[model samples]
Target chain A: MGKGILVVLSGPSGAGKGTICKAFLERNKSVRLSISCTTRAPREGEVDGVNYFFTEKEEFEKMIKEDKFLEYANVYGNFYGTPKSYVEETLNSGYDIILEIDTQGALNIKESFSDGVFIFVMPPSLDELKSRIIGRGTETEETLNKRFSSAADEIKLAEKYNYAVLNDTVENAVSKIESIITAEKCKINRIKDHMDVLQEV
Target chain B: MGKGILVVLSGPSGAGKGTICKAFLERNKSVRLSISCTTRAPREGEVDGVNYFFTEKEEFEKMIKEDKFLEYANVYGNFYGTPKSYVEETLNSGYDIILEIDTQGALNIKESFSDGVFIFVMPPSLDELKSRIIGRGTETEETLNKRFSSAADEIKLAEKYNYAVLNDTVENAVSKIESIITAEKCKINRIKDHMDVLQEV
Candidate 1:
């Protein structure tokens, strides 16, 4: 409670979760986005530590064995994980951190750190979400159906989150997230100053 | 969960809780202020519904017997209580309600409606609080010490509250309270609509 909050942001692929997270970071410069560790090689134009902390497959597996990752997932033949040390150290330094992950990753983090704030970004409706995915203009009918069904599955897990933000407008969603951060700081458990100040008086 | 929140605002008399609650109400019109019912007769200028809901002693006792109050206490020679029906009705219609009560009354409400969000407001220091009370120029030295000690006692119980606002400045305190209200609304348990919407889709 003395340290900064660890916020987990999750949603469907086209729910604008990333946009809201970006807007939050822009508005609150002290808040940082967590850089994930991945076993995959860096793609073209991607920078190490900027895009991700690319690690060898053996190193990733070793970290996983050591429980260094808060949550990890195996996609295709590559592993991607959120390093626990990075998150803990950043929060200890009094900088709030936001982690953008899929629904499965979010649930994994919940098991590891139940105290972290969990937020589920949602579209106004499934129809709106379908239209948003269509607006991307790059999906085949098969992939689009897969994505639509995946989104349907993810939305059902929204109940597990502590908060839900309807991503209807970027500005409105960002404002609400900002307020949530401010309010979390005022929680009785979070204000260690109150405990210390009263002790001296 | 479809209903609005019932927020309990409580603190010592000189802690500026009233000012913060008033500021919150002015900013959020949909959030109503809860009016208590009292067996004692209203003062000359006090109006029913606007002030306290005046009640006959027998009727008040009857309501108490019938479990019609969220909480009730016999103060001095009269009984004052929060009418359960009024609070439930307001929340049922989708309007959030804030109840400004003393520390004792706040504890009483906690017993009956534990879901209500409780917030405690505090002064920067007991010395500052004493000065503010003295600035009123209406209290004798003896009364001043009583209020000061009372506030100190009340602050010790602040950890029981869901949130605490240090009233360093009226504007800052009001801003924090507003954020708290907004955050509470986003709570997963409060927004059951998210679950319902996903099911329909």
Candidate 2:
């Protein structure tokens, strides 16, 4: 079997990126979603190690100074970062890692790690995207509009992504993601290690 | 849908590239195997367009001089080349093109065209590869060993390929190739065109 692949997923909020990542993990047993460390207060029902590796501001800053995160960003005054240790541990253990990150963070990760597959999820249509944002019921009308406008700007940057998976349906999106992982492993560079062993025989 | 992808496949003679390509095309109606323009006399029962596009040496040379062929080579004193027009026509017609070319031709095509996937097919194991070559019964013992030695050298060049497909089973190999074509269409650079058009509305 070929070594594992690193898949970085990004999309505008309400594009159902979280749901697709959950489905991908359910279908692929060998995949691990890298749990990010955040400086934000954990909401009710969120576990320390399960939902996120909750950290204090000072600790987060320390990690930053140490260059411990692959990429980090501040959201609403709270810092969220991907720890290099967990992702590396998962990959070294023969499991692929999936990082559900934002577009900026995805770009940063891609710059540092050129081999990671950067996928940007897309909504079916702008009207449909607006409807989904409204359906979330977690924001005001103005907030929803702001998100809708942000998606437009972000779509411009999506051209830099390695793949764009449209969330027309959950099932279809998950299928495309699975196919990408499978096809990526078959890439010549990733599987070249096996050939080196084959030559000795 | 985005423009169809062009995949150039190459491998050793007994690596089962033809079998894998045929099975893959059977499952994917969008994929068309590129037929080369050859100066060699057609074998018994080989159709003109199906087996190869037979051409006179003068016409073939004229195409070469006009820089029409993507890549051309002389094999056994007979010239064979992939016509750029046929491939471009097929792609423009919205069909994915698959060329069953050799390593040398595959490299030349890769250098000339930056896009399109380059897949190098290889047997699963050396012993298995030898068995497949021997089963063909077209070569004597001495020639068989020579061909086997050439396969070793060719596998070393697998580094130049975009993907290395192990032809362990026809069904599995075909599925992998089909998956690759499906995955390529989902690439962000390709799918973003449709999204860009949608955003304009």
Candidate 3:
């Protein structure tokens, strides 16, 4: 075994990314979901370290100045970031880390860390996505339409991703991503140490 | 559902690649081994279409001039080559085709068909490889030593392969190669049509 893999997952709102991530974590014991640091207050029932490392705005700014975040973004006045130390520690310990992020944040991480495997999850169809968003009932007609278009934009961007895992069913998607991880670990680039040892022998 | 993958497999002698390919075909119903055209006469118990597409020397030269072969070679006055049309037709019909070639031949295919997934199989260790080769009970001491060094050279060339699957066990190597096939199919470069249709929706 070598260093752990950094898997950066991104998908649109109705793409079932969160649900799939939940199932993945439940199945793979060696993998852990990366806990994000945020200036926003945690919701009810959310654990401090488990859900998010709730941080003060000034401290978050200080972390930014210190280059402590892999990638960070401000959305609606809330600063959310992926802490650098925890991810590095987990990988150095030879445990895989899954970073669930949106497209902009994923792109930022990709630029900084080219070693991470970037995956873009997708729904089967946009029509299904529209219906799912509509089924939520919380969104008004205008917001629903906005989200539908946003999904299309995200799908277009997926062409840049290394892999596109279709979330047709949670089970199939999970298995496909699992196979991707297994295959990645066998890549020639990742097995440099193994090859070096073999060559010397 | 999509165009089939061309998997080029190569390794040193006694890597058990032949056994692994046999098991792979038994397990994967959609995949078939590619048949090459050769000027050498069919061996005892070898069928024409099943074992090889045996052709006359003139015919093989004509096909080579016609650019019908993906890669061709002359060995001990015998000509052998992978026909371009047969492989394309099989893959076009959505059946994966495996080409079992030596390191030099595999590198030639890689240069021409970048879409083809190249895999290198390896023994668990050099000592194991030496023992396996000696167990064959055919080679003299001098020839065995020559073969050992040849294997080392082949292992060095494996750095260019897309994935390296260690032949620690036939089952494990076959399973990893299957996973690699699955993962390659999910790559964004291979799913342009799916992305296009999703974008249209």
Which candidate number would show the highest TM-score if scored against the true structure? Answer: 3
lDDT of each: 0.84, 0.82, 0.85
Residue A86 accuracy (lDDT) in model 1: 88
Better model by DockQ: candidate 2 vs candidate 3: 3
Locate the minimum summed-lDDT window of 10 residues in model 2 chain A: A192-201
lDDT of 2 at A157: 75
Candidate ordering by DockQ (highest first)? 3, 1, 2
Name the 10 consecutive residues with the lowest summed lDDT in model 3 chain A: A192-201
Mark the regions of model 2 whose C-alpha exceeds 4 Å error after superposition: A41-48, A56-59, A65-67, A140-146, A196-201, B41-46, B55-59, B62-68, B140-146, B196-198
Error of 3 at A162 (Å): 0.7
Q: In model 3, what is the error at residue B4, expressed in angstroms?
A: 1.1
Q: Which ten residues in a row have the lowest lDDT in candidate 2 chain B?
A: B192-201
lDDT of 2 by residue, B1-201 (tens): 457678998987788997887788788775788998999888666799986899999999999999999899986478989989888888877788999987878888898877889998978877787889898886778878778788778778888888888887899888788777767888876676666424653
Candidate with top DockQ is 3
lDDT per residue as tens, model 1, A1-201: 368899998888788887888788888898989988988877667789976899999998899899999899985367889998889999998889998887888898999798799999988888888899998776679878878888888888888999988787999888888888888988888884645435534
Candidate 1 regions exceeding 4 Å error are A40-48, A56-58, A137-145, A192-197, B38-67, B76-78, B137-145, B194-196
TM-score of each: 0.88, 0.90, 0.91
Second chain TM-score per prediction?
0.84, 0.88, 0.87
Stretches of model 3 off by over 4 angstroms after superposition: A41-45, A134-146, B39-47, B55-58, B75-78, B137-145
